[model samples]
Target: MFAWFKRKFAKSEAAPAQQERHFMRNRTGARMFAAARQDRLGTAWGGTPLTADEIVDRNQVVLVARSREQSANNDYGRSFLRMCRQNIVGPKGVMLQAQSMTARGKLDNAANQAIEDSWLEWGKRQNCDVTGRRSWRAIQNNCITSAAKDGEFMVRLVFGADGGPWGFALQVLDPQRCPIDLNDQRPRTGAFIRQGIEFNRYGRPLAYYFTTTDESEAGYHWGGKSYVRIPAEEIIHGFLEDMVGQKRGLPWMATALFRMRQLGAMEEAAIIKARTGANQMGFIEWDDGFGPETKEKDDEELTIESEPGEWRVLPSGARVKESNPQYPTGEYAPFYKQALRGMAAGFGVLYNNLASDLEGVNFSSIRQGTLDEREHWKDLQEWLIESLIEPVFEAWLPRALLAGLIKVKGKPLPAERLDQYRVVEWQARRWQWIDPRADVNSAVEAKNNMLTSPGKLIREQGQDPQTVWQESARDVAAMIEAYKSEGIDEATAKELVLLSMGRPQPKVAPTGGNTNEAA
Candidate 1:
């Protein structure tokens, strides 16, 4: 029985070896031509021998430094930034709302008001925006636009005596000055590992390396020790991450390079063809001409050099022929539109938004596209609020309160409770209804059924409900006062308000006529 078991085990092992030999043969016949015929050739994608660091280095130098990446801001990249502004920042940029949850169900209106007023005052100060050129809205637009164009933006906090415990100013940095190479000058605990960002073993960033001056400045050293180390706490980095463990930012225009460049070349060629083709070229007869074809046998071959804005003079008896390619510019539109559509996909924006083209787009199609695009914008807004805005507010809150620059309920807030007041809400960009009639009806029905709330709808519109209600109340009071001044009653004024809001008044029966006749 033992001998029989050994034989069975040996046969089982042999069967696997035989199956392995068969399995080793390529089962998928769709491999590339070169790998299919060769026994040793492997797939090209996985065959790359470089490590992650090497790959990043190559991408930094070769891809990030490309001319297209630099010019992207003035080129097609504008559309991407425009979308970011329209969907993320809107006209007002990001708005802050301080809601104190420490008060339990009841809002700490005084505390919230104090925090908001102080922050607003601090932001409105001259040079509050470190650049000294931008207002709050302008700086918000600048930071977002910079991140989109350059793939990353770094904001430095300059704290000093402008107001509060310490007045703070924000300065956005150029990514070019931030080096991505490792320096041996730091400790060996991986605390200063990786490019511009230095991280500890736990992978938390500690510092950043930045150059002393912009390279474009006059008398700037092209070759020198121009780097300075900045602590991570003083900086806010804004970037849309595309890969895990990616140390640097990459522009949204990176993937669209191939298509953008090709379209540019094609259109440039078309322009040349159109403009040059319009010029008439003539061949002169031998009567008394200098045309190459009309030159005498004894005379050297003659040529009329055509310079821009220079007329080509011809003798009598000359025959002119149109050398136009006759290719219509409209032919390039479809190709451009198709390429633009693909590029828009890479940008994560709708083609209609980027191209501003509504051709062939129905309500359902546009709505679907807008819904997906809005979701992505919302995600971006959340990231910005969480990563950039929240941290800044937290850093600013304690300092402002301790400096006695801000007061809660007309008294200085306790420093211990600073953390409690730090909890705040940021309103992101919102959209108006595409079809207000239907959407408003739906919203009304949902509200009546307790499926949604006014606050939720107000937030969806990128507004603070309290603010909206206050404004509306003020408007209603003003309307009543104006109607009273004109000898109209409060009820009539309120009815007018309803009528203005698209709620029509019911028809009344005539006083002395039949009800049927009135109807």
Candidate 2:
């Protein structure tokens, strides 16, 4: 029996070796793909193909917690939050333009003005947000920051009695209210819950299952089941979807979280070392326990206090060795910059912007980096407009119209033409020129060549083009009147008004000779 068992064990041990050899022999094209080979280098590399929902369900909570902690404590993390808020939402939030038109294809200025004016009023802190504390800009700031830190932002719409005068209000909820692992077999209908989101046969979110009580509240348990079903239409969930079937968002800084933590710990250690070195003058060593023979306690007898410009004579057989500590070595700055560069790349931002270190960057490099970073910010801004702004406006407009809040000349707007009034154009915040002269020259070239328009240029500067045109016309008329009153001719007054408005004058050449224009 012992011999049989020994033979069986040997066979079992040899089987894996034999199988590995066989597998290697069949892999003739293994060199084509280094990663596919089961070689020594690839032994420790392993992965599993998980669905998007499964992966999100498994990692969302942990990633969000770590991201929040980092953003709260780490400088780079906080910088990222600030950058998102400022660049994506800006000081003034995204502006709205109503594009309602008459049947003759002309702009219905009356309806548009009424809608715009009412929207501006409704966007106030006491009217727009359910909590009555966050204005339109603040809500946008929170949405962007929350999405950057937690990977998603959730807002619930309150209407009728629960809302403000316009019968519309927004309630921002913590992403934690919707549990990540709350998968349940939702009754009757073929829908089911995955990561607190209920999906139908087509994977469309039908409803969200949110816990009524927060985890921080008293008597809260992980397994306790108290969920409120909110329909998908009523909830505005904003997240960056990386995959087609992704149900949840992964934090924007998830990839760099580990590096940020490690870098923070390293910086702390370096600071402590430098501080310790700066404070310690030297160390006193006593020869083999032969120290001062004072009546004080043994521990206190060896304790020597020294002050500036003072010298102390040590006891017999004692020697002082000056101490020197070299901390934050030459490699530290390079390592730190390289790590931050990697993190910045992960966060889709410029290293200079992320680290606020513009030491060696010139105009060209800084301009390129700023352009790339602006593109990233623009992408997020577009996402926010589509995911949150448009939907909220669509929902709010109908409620405001029905409640007789939206009016034209003290008369209520017709609710029958809701579709016409719903057409809106959002003007997002734009960056200022880095080199004003160069930028202006390029813009002039573009305008002269018909590559751009006045409206486009005005919009790029974060101003409404139509409003600018009206203001310009009004200012020019006023200027012309003022100039005419000063005994100037009508045509020259118009010309002076144009010149004052920064319009270039038409240069007339002399009779025959070629006119040379000064640059």
- What would the per-residue lDDT of candidate 1 be over residues 1-519, giving only the tens digit for each residue? 999999999999999999887766554453436544534455344544665556565665455555335456335656677788777778877788888756577777788878888777666636456556666666677777767766677877778863223477777677666765654435656465576677886768788877653435543223345567888898888777666666677765678767777877777788887777676454434545434453456767445677899888765555445464666556688888999899899888999988889999999999999989989999988977876777777777877887787786568887788767877889988988988999999998999899999899899898988778889889878887898889988889888877876797799856765766778
Where does candidate 2 clash, by residue pair?
Answer: none
The alpha-carbon deviation from the true structure for residue 43 of candidate 1, after best TM-score superposition, in angstroms, is: 8.5
| Deviation (Å) of 516 in candidate 2 | 20
Worst 10 residues of 2 by lDDT: 213-222
Model 1, runs deviating above 4 Å? 1-25, 29-46, 49-52, 67-74, 101-104, 125-127, 162-166, 183-190, 213-226, 281-322, 328-331, 407-414, 481-519
Q: For candidate 1, give the lDDT of residue 273.
A: 75
Q: Candidate 1, after superposition: displacement of residue 349 in Å?
A: 1.4
| Per-residue C-alpha lDDT of model 2 across residues 1-519, encoded as one tens digit per residue | 999999999999999999999888777666677777776777788656788987897788899989999999999999999989989988789999888999999889899989999999999999998878999889999999889999999999888877886678999888787888788775688888888899996789998987762425543235558888999988999999998799888999999999999999999999999999999888777787676655656555356777999999877889888889988889899999999999999999999999999998899999999998999999988999999999999898887888788888899999989999998899889999989999999998999999999889999998888788888889888988998999999999988877877888789756544444431
Instruction: Give candidate 1's error at residue 403 in angstroms.
Output: 1.8
Off by over 4 Å in 2: 1-28, 39-44, 186-188, 213-221, 286-316, 486-489, 503-519
